[model samples]
Target: MHIEQLKQKIVAALEDLKAQDLTILDVKAATSVTDYMIIASGTSSRQVMALARNVQSTAKELDVELLGMEGLDAGEWVLVDLGDILVHLMQPQIRELYDLEKLWGEFANPINHQA
Candidate 1:
């Protein structure tokens, strides 16, 4: 699937499930690991995990396979790798420390978005 398409799908799933501070970063020009990075926060651990799982399942329905999932135990943050779309579902604390938005803020050049 296209990176842009996957990014939109993940964003929609998170928004429908009420994830907050939705941020999508296009890293295709920056890194080879992935084409995009989706960072969002959920109020609690359960919510964060749920958002990750929902995203995973939805992507599957669309045939977007995950490379792997991490941080399902304490669930502070769940990283879902969708080849071109890397999702970061985090609680406030985890999100703060990682500061993904800050890291990508300077590089998030607005591009065509379907979502």
Candidate 2:
């Protein structure tokens, strides 16, 4: 799938679970690791895990490889690696602490989305 289509699917998956603070950062020019960084917040650990799982399932349907998943046990911050897209599902508190959006925001234009 194209990057834009993949990003849409990811946003849909996150919205399916009612994820908050959804932000899509375009890091293509800033980094070679991934084209886009999707950051969202789930209310709790279970919700965080659920959000990640939803992304995984959706990605599978799209034929996107699930590179890896991290922080599932702790559920504080789960990172989903899909070849060109890196998803970060975190609790509101954790999101605030790390402020990943700002970190990556500095490097390039970060697209602030409201799904």
Candidate 3:
């Protein structure tokens, strides 16, 4: 699938599960690992795990390769690695503590997903 389509599918998967504070960071210039980093928060550990699962399912449905996943056991944070994109699902407190937006702030452009 195209990158944009893959992104949309991933975002929709998160939104379907009511993921909060969805932020898409264009990190093409900052990192070589992935072109985009999607960050979102879940209200609780269960929600975080659910969101990650949904994203994984969506990627599978779209035939996107799932490179890796992490932090699912603890559910404090979950990282879904697609070849060109990385999805981060975390509880609100963990999200606030890590401050990924700020970490990538300098080089990442926050894409406005608003209509």
By TM-score, the best candidate is 3
- Winner by TM-score between candidate 3 and candidate 1: 3
Give candidates' CA RMSD values in order: 2.2, 0.9, 1.0
Model 2 lDDT per residue over 6-32, tens place: 999899999999998898888899989
Ranking by lDDT: 3, 2, 1
> Each prediction's Cα lDDT score?
0.83, 0.92, 0.93
Candidate 3 TM-score versus the reference: 0.97
lDDT of 2 at 33: 94
lDDT of 3 by residue, 11-93 (tens): 99999999999999999988898999999999999999999999999988888889999999999999999979999999999
Candidate 3: worst-modelled 10 consecutive residues by lDDT: 106-115
What are the TM-scores, per candidate, against the unseen true structure? Answer: 0.88, 0.96, 0.97
**Local accuracy of candidate 1 as per-residue lDDT tens digits, 24-97:** 78777777888778888999999998998899898888997778999977789999988888889999998999
